[model samples]
Target: MEHSRIAVAGASGLIGAALVRSLAADGHEVVRLVRREPRTPDEVRWDPERKYVDPAGLAGCDAVVNLAGANVGSRRWTDAYKARIRDSRVLGTTALAEAVASLDRPPRVFVNGSAMGIYGETGDRAVDEDAPPGEGFLPELCVEWEGAAAPARAAGVRTVFTRTGLVVSREGGAWGRLFPLFKAGLGGRMGDGRQYWSFVSLHDEVAAIRHLIDTDGLSGPFNITAPHPLTNAEITAAMGRVLHRPTLFTVPAPVLRAVLGEMAGDVLGSQRVLPMRLLESGFTFAFPEIEEAIRAAK
Candidate 1:
């Protein structure tokens, strides 16, 4: 793959940070676009809320990856919180798309961040990139998020929406929260324990993004999840096994609802997503199984 100048928004966040490191290690010149005034040479200041970006700073970049968004699980989905979630993704994406589209030498590819929640809760049925989006807040948000990138696509830039699953990592994400509980032998399934927990290792998530950047033939939504997905019960068991702990507790649906409100659906909803397009593209997964991924992260 040719090393190209890449600009990444949301560079301080989990996935964004990982991508910055990966891009740098791959020998690409990475410029980080941040909200605050950049104090370093590698960073560029841009405020998505204000819809302002220095186009000169974005010039000469061959690719751009937008990962800016409000943390969905950070707060209760009151009307205000819901609006923030929608606005954050839509506005942030639109800002980047407009900036890229206006560039005289615009980026050749735009790899935008999205989520598998776009497909809603799919129970045990496997959904891929081609699956029609289902229902609920997440699906609707993802639709608008992807739509915000339409300008770049319409301008002839190769756009890819990375529909990510539950990215398992020891440093952050759900795995970080679950590790302590499982280690204490209090971790268990929420609700029925039958809901599928579609997931990907942090390693595979980064690799697939890089793979997309290299494979020009790939565009549109690509499921950034492991080939093998597991149900909540299975995930609990695997984590228990990995931590050498017991998985005997169960959080009732009503109790979870009381605690998390609408966010509880995030814990209970099922999304059995698969990386059909990525696999068909000949991209190999470093950790395809839940147990193996858990052990590697541990």
Candidate 2:
């Protein structure tokens, strides 16, 4: 892909950091929109609560990717924290979208980050980008989260909701916590181990986002996951195999709920998501299997 000027919000996040490195490696000029005051040449300032962004800093950018949001699993789901989670995504996305839309030479595309939890519990049934949003908090939050980007779409900027899945990376995310436990042979399935997890390697996640940035014809929701979806038990086995450990233990559903509180529902919920749109667009995954993704994360 030819080098282009791209602005990225949430540049300090796990996925955002990876994307910045990827883009820079590819010779793209990346302007990181930070929450704090800009201290560097490539850093721009934005405040989500105030919905402020300096339009001059974003002018002439080819594309903008919004990944700003509170970490859902960062704390116990207190009502206040939950509100913070919702507000972070909605307000942050709205801020970025409105800013991008207002630019005199607005970005051609807005790659907004979303999640696979939008599908809720699907059991073994496979779903695609066209699948309707499911019930519960995550699905509801995702709906509002994606909706916050409407201004960009309405302004004629192609908006793509990158509905990402469980990204395998030891640096951060769900796997960050798992790596230590798994390495110590404490890794095990949470609940009956039947819940399907739609996962992708961190490498693939970054690559897919870059793909969307370069692909002009792609827009709207695109599921960013591997072709193979694995159940919790399968994932446990893959981790054990990759790390040369054992996966003979399991966490009961009730205990998981008691420990994780309401967030446990997502931990146990099954979502068999597919990348139908991504496949049709001719995008390829570097690690499409659970084992490969687990190994690659190391």
Candidate 3:
């Protein structure tokens, strides 16, 4: 792949930091957009809330990737926090999209961050990129989030939505919180453990993003998840087996709802997601199975 200048919003995030590193290491020039004043030569200032991005920062870039959003799993889903979650994604995406559209010489592609939550509760059915979004708060939020990139798409930029799944890693995110609990033998399945979790290793997650950036003739939504998804119970077993710990506990559905509030529905929901488009595009995963992903995180 040719080394290209790439501008990335949310470069401090878990995936963004990794991507910036991966790109820089591979000789790609990366311009990081920060909310604060730019400290480094490659850094630029942008206030997504106010819908402002330094167009000069994006000039002459091959691609623009936006991963800015308030983390859904970071806290309890109170009404205010829920609004923050929605606004952060929608507003930021709109800001970036508009900026990309305004550029006289636009980038070749725009890869906007998204999530598998758009599919809502898929239960036991296997769904792919072509499936219509499911109902409820998360799915609705995802729709608004992805739709915020309309300006870029309308401007003829090859926009791609990375409908990512649960990224497996030890640094941060949902799986990060589990490593400690499982090691202490306090880890167990949530609810009835029947809900499926579509997961991809952090390595694969960053790889898929780079793949989307580098590959030609790829646009629209791509499920950035491992092909094989496992039930919650199966995941629990894998955790225990990998850590040599006992999985003897379960967090009931009622308790989850009580603690997480509106967020619990997503915790217990099933999404047997398949990365059909990504697979068809010939992207191979470094960690395709739960055990393999877990070990990589370790």
Candidate 4:
């Protein structure tokens, strides 16, 4: 791949940090947009909450990846919390777009972050990039988030919205949180465990991002998930198998609803998403199956 200067917003987050490391390793010049002053010169300070970004620093970049957003699952969706969640994404994306729009030499591509929640609960139906979005707060937020990048697209920049799935990694992410419980033989399915868990390994997540950055033909919403999605029960079983633990403890739906409220719906919702666009674009998946992804993460 040809080396290019890249700017990554939200460079402190899980995906952003990983992408920065990967890009740097791949010989690409990476400039991280941060909320605070970086201890090093490679970082650029930007305050999205304050609506200020260094537009001058953003110029001359080949690509810009926006991964800024509030953690949706970090708190209950009180009306205020929900508003914050929505605003964070939209505001951050809009800031990036505006900054790029003002740049003398704007990036050629803008890869923005989104989530599989954009598709809502697809149940058993396999969804793809071409699939219409579904209903729910998350789906709605994703739609607005993606829409916030319109200025960049209108500026002739090829924009790519990555609707990511459950990112499984041993270091941090959903798998890290579940590892201890499952390892202690107390891991179990949430609700009936039949809901499909669309997932991808962290390795594949970063790989797919790099692929999209390099592949100019790729644009629009691309589902960044493994080809072979599994149900909650299957995921529980697989984790148990990997850890040599029993997979008998099942968290009842009523309990989950009582504890998580609207968030519980996300845990129980079914979304059997497919990466049709990535596949058609000839982007090969490093870990297509759950077992392979799990073993690699393990």
Most accurate candidate by TM-score: 3
Ranking by lDDT: 3, 2, 1, 4
| Candidates' C-alpha lDDT | 0.88, 0.91, 0.94, 0.88
Q: How large is the C-alpha RMSD of every model relative to the true structure?
A: 1.1, 0.9, 0.8, 1.3
Quote the lDDT for 276 in model 4: 86
Q: Count the backbone clashes (under 3 Å) in each candidate.
A: 0, 0, 0, 0
- TM-score of each model, paired residue for residue: 0.97, 0.98, 0.99, 0.96
Q: Please write out the lDDT profile of model 3 over residues 36-87, one tens digit for every residue.
A: 9999989978998788898888999999999988889989988999888888
Per-residue lDDT of candidate 2, residues 27-144 (tens digit) = 9999999878889989888987677887788998999999988998766788898998898889988988998888888888999999998999999999999899999899999999
Question: Which residue pairs in candidate 3 collide?
Answer: none
List the candidate 4 regions with Cα displacement exceeding 4 Å: none
Arranged by TM-score, best first: 3, 2, 1, 4
Better by TM-score, candidate 2 or 1? 2
lDDT of 1 by residue, 1-298 (tens): 7778999988887788898898899799999998888898878888876667777888999888988888887767888889888887888899898888999889879999999989998887988888899888999999999999998998889999999888888777778788888988999988999999888988888899889888887899999999888889999999988899989999999998898889999999988998999999999999999998998788
Q: Which is the winner by TM-score between candidate 2 and candidate 3?
A: 3
